[model samples]
Target chain A: MSEDKREMFDEQDDGKVKESRRDFLKKIGVAAAATAAVPAATAKAVSIAETLQSHFELMSDEQKQKAIARLEKRYSEQFGKQTTVANTPAPDGVLFGYALNISKCIGCRRCVEACVRENNQSRDPKIQWIRVLRMNRGNLTFDPKHLNEGKPSSDPLGNYGIQSGGHADKAVGISGEAEHYYNPEQVPEENAFYFPVQCQQCEDPACTRACPVRATYRDPNGIVVIDYNWCIGCRMCQLACPYWARRFNWSEPVLPNEDMNPKTHYLGNRPRMVGVMEKCTFCLQRVRDGRYPACVEACPVGARKFGNLLDPESEVRKVLATKQVFRFKEDFNTEPKFFYYMD
Target chain B: MAEEQMVSVGRRKGQDEVIADKRVFLKRAAAALGVVAAAGLTGTAVIQSARKVGGTNARARCAEEDVRQQQIMVGKQLLLMTEGEKQQMLDRILSSHSRKVS
Candidate 1:
C-alpha cells in the first residue's frame, strides 16, 4: 500500500479497537448494576419504587394515591398492624390557630407525654416536640424596691428609671434560666409557672424558608408540615427555627410496635425514618378529622385551646379577642399562629 | 481454482453457523425477559390485593373507634362543666371548628 493508504488503515484499526473497548465497559456496567439490584429487590427492606418516588408536592393526584397506598402497605407490614397514612388536605375557609392559657398550666407534662404517644415519636431516643419551661415567677415581676437602684447618680440623662433587680432589663416573659427537665414531687411548683413551647406554625416560617429542598412548607390551614421522605437531613430547618421547635432523628427510631400510633397522617405523625427532621404538626391527623389534638385533650387544666382562627366564635379567636394573648418571639416577625394567653 | 473454491465454501459455512448461534441466543434472552415481566406483574397484583383487604378492614375499625372516642371526650368535657359552661361548650362544639370542611 501507498504511504497515505497505510496511515488511513492504521486510523481505522485504532477506531475499531476503541469502539470495542467502550462496548465491553458498557456491558460490564450493566451487568454490575443488575447484580446489585437483585439483592436489593430480594431483601425487601427498601423498595426500589420508594427510592425512586417523586416529591410529594410535585406528584399528581393519581401518583399521590399510589404513593399513599405504597406507604400504607409498607407501614402495615413493618409495624405488624394495619396503618392508615392519611393524605388529608387542609380545609378551605379555615385557618388553624392554637391558644394556651399559661396561667392555668400547672407545670404538668401530660401534654408532652400525650404528644409523644399520639405522634408515634421515638420512645428510646425520646424525641419530644413540646418543651415545657418552668419559669420563675420572680423573673416575671419588677420589685418596686429596685426602682431606684439602676438610676445613675447625678447622670446627664437624669433618671431614666433604669432598674436592675427582678430582671428589670432582662426579657421578662420567658427567662433563659427556665428549667426544662424539672421533675418535682408534684407539679404547680410554688414561685414557678409552666410555659409549654412547640411549633408556632408561623405564617412566615423561617424553617421552611431555610429548607434547601422545599421539604418543609406551610399548608393552607397555617400548619407547617415537613415531607420526611424528601428531607435531605441537612438540619438547615432545625438551625433556622427560632423557637427551637424542630427535632432530628439521629439514629434509627426505636418505637415499640405496641406503642406506635396506627392513626397517622402522611405529613404529620406517621412513623419517620432516620436522619429526617420532625416536629409538631399541630396534630394535623386529628385536627383535620375534626377532633382535637392529643395534647389539647390531654391537658388536665384545659390550658391548651384549638380552633379555627377565621371563625369569630372559635375558642382560639375568642382568646385572641378577649384575653391578653402574646406570641413567643414576636419580635422575629414570624407571625406565629400559636398564641399564649393569660386567663 | 479448485482449492480456492473449497476455502470459500468453508468460510461461508462458518458464517452461517455464527448467525445461527446469534439467533439462538436472542431467542433465549427474549424468553427470559418475558418470564421476568410476567412474574413481576403477577407478584405486584397479589401484593396489592392483600394490602387492599387489610387496609379496608383496619380503616373501618379505626373510624368506628374514633367516633366513639370523640363522643366520650365530648361527654366527659360536658360532665365536668357547670350548666352555663355546658351551654357554651355545646355551642362551641357545634360550631364550624368541629365541622370537617373537607
Candidate 2:
C-alpha cells in the first residue's frame, strides 16, 4: 500500500507483468505442494522401505536415523498425538535383572493392566505381558514323577511351591495341584499364594534361538526383544519358552488411535501390526531412560524388583546375593535373568 | 536305609489311594528330620530345621564375600521398603512366626 511500491507495480509492462506474476505464482504453488507432499509421500514411501529394510544390525547409522524419524512422524499421524519413537541403546556396564517376591504379590492384576496399556497390546483380545497365577498354598515339590506326567509347570510360578527354595522343595507338606487361572472377586486368596510370571529375559534365550530369522534376540542390556517388522509370526518362540511369555498378535492390535502409547522403543513397545510375536521387554522404553518398568510402578506391594545386576550396590544384585533365588526351570538351562526369591 | 525308605514310600502309594491322616503327619515329621540332616548343618542348622522350615539355611553355604554382598543387599532393600515394610522385615529377621501361633 506504499505509493512507491504501487507505482513500481503500475509502471511494469502489462503483458510481461501478467506473464512474470503468473510464472511466480506457479513456482510458489508448486513449491508449497511439494513441501506438503514430501512428508505424506515420504511416509508412504518409508512404510514400503520399512518392510524391505535390512535387519537393524545391518543398517547404517544414517539409515537408522531416517527410519526412526519417519516412523515417529508416521505414528504421530496415525495415532493423532505427538509420538516419539527412538532407538535408545543400552548403556555400557549395565546388565539388567528382575526379582519377584512371590509371597508379597497379592494377585491384584494391576501390573497386568499396566503392561497392556504401556505396550499398546490388543484391547479386545487382551494381550498381556504379565500373568498372575493363583495357586493353593500347600505342600508342593518338584517330584520327578510329576515332570514325567506333564510339562513342568506350563503355568510357570502358578504352582510355585515346587519352583525351589520353599517348603514345597522337600516334598513334605500338603499335596494338590494349583487351582490355576483363578479369577476371584477378591484376591489374596485364603491360604493361597500369587506367582506373577513374565519373560525371564534369559541370558541364553531359548526364544531367540528358536527364531529361524533371529527376529527375536536379546539386547546387550539383558532384555529379550522381538523386532516386530522382521518377525514372521511362526510362534516357534512360544513353544520353546518354558515360561510361556511370548504372545502372538492374531489380528492387528485393537488399540484405539487415541489410546496408543505415543512413546515407543524400536525394539520394545511400538504398536505392532498383526502376525508378530511379542513378549515383555521389561519396559525397555522406560528402563533405558532410568525409570522403573510400568508394572513395577503400578505394583502397590513392592513385590517386583528390577535393577542393573552388574552394579554391586543395586537392589537386584543385593537381593540375589542375600536371598534364595531360583529360575522357573533351572534344568532347562535357559539361564533366565528373572528370579523368584524370598528373603 | 535311604533306598528302603524310598521303596516304602512307593509301596505306600501303591497300597493306598489316599494316605491315612495319621500317616500324613508321620510322613511330615520324618521328612522334617530328613531336611535337618540334609542342610549340611552349620551353626544355625538345628534351630532353623527344628522350626519345620529345614529347606532354608539362614547361614547356609555363604562365604565371606557372599556375607558382604548380602549385607550390602540388605542395605539396598531397606531403602526400597516403606516404614511399615521395614518393621515387618525387622520382625521376620528378629523372630520366627511365634506371634502367628498365639
Candidate 3:
C-alpha cells in the first residue's frame, strides 16, 4: 500500500515539487478565468439595482430605455427566450364583462385548479387566485358553511360532529349556536351553491386608488393592470380591495415544467415574481389576443360567460340585458364588471 | 483664509481618493462573486431553498405512471385514494358547471 501511495505522489511531481506547484496554480487560474469569462454578474446586478431605485414613470428617457433593455435581458436568462412586452390592443368597440351562474356552480373547484395552472400562480396556501365559498341554503343568520371552503371541509364524520361553537368559546360568539346545529345529513344538500370569487375588475377599481405609485391602473378597455416592473410590493392594494380579490406572492411559485403554459400574457397569467400582488386580470392577455380565459375554458358547466359589454352584439351584453344579475358588494360602489345571474 | 484654503484642499483630495478606492473595491468584488455565482454555485444554494419565488414551478420528480397514481392529503395525514373517487369528483364539477351555461 505504501509503495502504491508513493507512486501516486511521484506522478504528481514534475521533476521538482516547486515547478509542479506553479503548473497546478496555473491550471486553477485558467479554469477560474474561463468561468469568469461569461460576463460574471456585473451588468445584470447593476441593471436590476437600477430598476429598484427608479420610479418607472419618473425615469428619464435614457433610464426608460435602459429599463426596457434590462427587462428583455433578464427575462431571456430566466425563461430562455427574450420576452417582448407587447401592447395588447383591445378589439374595436369592446368592453370586457363577466357573468357567473350561481345555480350551476358545484362545490367541486375545477375552475380554481385551471386558473392556478393557467396563471402560473404561486403554491402558497394564501395565494389562490380563485376562492370557492360553500354556503348552505336557509342558514340566513350564521353561515358557518359560507366560510372559505378552500380545501374540502375536514371529513364531516371524523371531524364533523364537533360544533364550531364547541371548538372554542370564542367561536361561540363568532359562529353562534347555528354552528353546533349542523347535521351530517344536511351536507351535500341540493340547495347548496359554490361561489367562485376573483378580481371583480371593477369599472371604478379600488385597487387602483390604493397604489401610491399608480403602478396599477384601468386600461381603456376597463381591465385593471399592474406594471410588474413598476410594482413596489407595498401590498396596499390588497388592503384597499373590498372583495379580498388581490393575492400577494410571499414566495416564488412552484409549477411543474410540464404543466407550465408557455403561452404567456404580460397582464394575465404570465409567471410573476415574489413580493408582487396578482389577481384575475380577467385573462386580459387572452381576451385582447382573441382567446378565451383558461377558467372560461375549464368551466365544464359553462357557468362563466366572458364578452364585451359595449358591443350590442356581444354575448355578455345580451346576458346582462336579458337576465337578472347580482354583483357582490354592490353597495361599496366598486362597479365590478363581474356579475352573477340565476340560471 | 490661507489655513482654511489648505484644510479644504486636503479634505477634498482625501475624499476623492477614498471614493475612488471604494468604487474599485466594489467593482472587483462584484466581478469575483458574479463569476462564482454563475458557475451555478450560488444558484444551487438558491435552488436548495424549498421556498419558491417568481412564477416558476417545481418539476415533478415522479414518472408518468406515478402521476397517474392517486394520492390524498387529509389534515397532516397522507392517504391513497381510489382513482374512481378522483374521476367522480372531476366529473361532478364538470357536469354541474356545464348545466348552467345554456
Give me the runs in candidate 2 sitting further than 4 Å from their true place. A1-46, A142-180, B1-102
Best candidate, lDDT: 1
Q: Provide fnat values for all models in the order shown.
A: 0.00, 0.00, 0.03
Clashes of 2: 0
Candidate 1 local lDDT, residue A31 = 57
Best by TM-score: 1
Weakest 10 consecutive residues, lDDT, candidate 2 chain A?
A163-172
Better of 1 and 3 by DockQ: 3
Task: Give the lDDT of residue A263 in candidate 2.
Answer: 92
TM-score of chain B of each: 0.51, 0.22, 0.38
For residues A64-104, write the lDDT of model 3, one tens digit per residue. Answer: 66665565555556666545543455666566778887667
Residue-wise lDDT of candidate 2 within A1-343, one digit each (tens)? 3644643554464446557656755665555555444443532333777778777766899988877887888889878998898798887767788889876889999999899899888774566777776655532443433432322333333444332222434232223343335788898878677667788887767888889999988777868888887898898988788777777766545689877999999988988875688889999999998999999899999988999876768888677666655556555657677877765
TM-score of each candidate?
A: 0.64, 0.60, 0.56
Q: How much does candidate 3 score in TM-score?
A: 0.56
Q: Cα lDDT for residue A30, model 1?
A: 57
What is every candidate's C-alpha DockQ against the true complex, given to 2 decimals?
0.03, 0.00, 0.03
Model 1 lDDT per residue over A275-335, tens place = 7899999999999989999999999999999999778899987876666555666557676
Which lDDT value does model 2 have at B58? 15
Between candidates 1 and 2, which one is better according to lDDT?
1
User: Each prediction's Cα lDDT score?
Assistant: 0.71, 0.66, 0.58
Q: Which 10-residue span in candidate 1 chain A carries the lowest summed lDDT? A: A152-161
